[model samples]
Target: MTASPAFERLAIVGIGLIGSSLARAVRAEGLARTIVCADANADHAARAKAIGIVDEATTDPAEAAAGADLVMLCVPIGAYADVARTIGPALKPGAIVTDVGSVKQAVIDAVAPHLPEGVHLVPGHPVAGTEKSGPDAGFAALFPGRWCILTPVPGADEGATRKVADLWRACGMTVERMDPGHHDRVLAITSHLPHLIAYTIVGTATDLEEHLRQEVIKYSASGFRDFTRIAGSDPTMWRDVFLNNREAVLDCLQRFTEDLTALQRSIRRGEGDALFDLFTRTREIRKGVLDARQA
Candidate 1:
């Protein structure tokens, strides 16, 4: 219940799931003196304000960011540059700029140039979210016990990075510092590739004949339902993620394809031992993930 260092104002641009969740966390933990949010969708902005999650909400990024000590960009990766450009001139001197973007390198590239002198850029990803989106989908518990990776570029203000890290910790997240490229590579495998496979498999199932598709939906409880949940994630967010992390995702996809082809060959040849060994190995990996508390 300790209060976080007070910031005059904390601006969140994009009152979607992540943005609204941060607003709730900031308020619940008293991380900021004031929390303001903006969304391109007026309804979303109004909903955030009406829900009392944020102190103020607006439709303009500049208005939201004006004079704020911390300005967080919580929009789709594709919208980062435009939002950054819009809020750049409105940022107060010495303000810290951060983001909850899944992709790190793209965010840094998109926002760094527009920031004025003395402003800090701290790119971060909270490795926790549900498939659902929008302001109403958010809750204060979204961040607790989650990993919040901060990838601050060289020359970023140390104080600013620490302040952001502290804020996440105050919200019950464990903070980790990592290189942007490394963060992207790790997320490519852990998050991006999984989402891609889910999307692909779900899309393929949707292409089946009407009867088969109905049956697929009816009998989806085994494992297909999991994929459906992932595939159900916001289309705009996933699309921007793939476009922004193109190279890393493609690299992981290539490797995944090679491994899948090997498994297909084993199955076609009726190599029981090979299939058994592969499944056992993957099961061990699943165990490892569970043990690491990252599953």
Candidate 2:
């Protein structure tokens, strides 16, 4: 495989799972001559450096971004604006500013105003992740076979967007261009709603009678275990995602709740046919997910 042009330095703000993973991938593929990371949590920055994930690690975002060819924001959506403000003055002219934030429009709105005229803003989301957080949770293989969506604002440089896309492709992702609003709507169903449900069920289980709670944990198998895994994701990141995508998530939630009520009514009325029909339809949905390679 041919190697892409190496960035002089790739700065990653927020040395968490995604950030550290990007660091590893960049180093492993020789995509950058240097990888620098910054984290609000000083210990995380120190840890990333100690583990050799980044050539330089700092607690200040400006220090990390200064002189870098590309800078990727990997923090929670809520922190994007603050990070952008901190790094704006430090970014080099023509530097590409991108992000791996799950919610695209909010991030774009938050970061765009702070960027200098010559700096490029290419908002992106790697439609891939796990319930884990922190630098240690990252691995180079995390991005392989996943989709990376870039939502470039009007008048943004095409060359910058292509460079970011090329970086993700080098890390083993399939790159796609998408509208921010459309991306938000799609993720509301595919990602957000599922996380909300997982959190809800896990929270409900915790409120059960003490003995029942213990039993639930002891007996949790396939489905419940899966929910638990999702519930374990970084609270800060997931919370920001929900708040940033509130409208889309709430719209999806309204439909989901009505469908759930119907299922509840079917079970209460002992309507086997109604229950079976719903179950059959849901099974078909599951099959579609499997066919799409997303299940």
Expressed as tens digits, the lDDT of each residue in 170-241 for candidate 2 is 999999999999999999999999999999999999999999999999989957989999999999999999
RMSD to the true structure for each prediction, in A, is 1.1, 1.4
Screening candidate 2 with a backbone cut-off below 3 angstroms (N, C-alpha, C), the clashing residue pairs are none
In order, candidate lDDTs are: 0.93, 0.93
Per-residue lDDT of candidate 1, residues 137-190 (tens digit): 999899998999999998878999999998899889999999999999999999
- Provide the TM-score for each candidate, comma-separated: 0.98, 0.97
Q: Which ten residues in a row are the worst by lDDT in model 2? A: 1-10
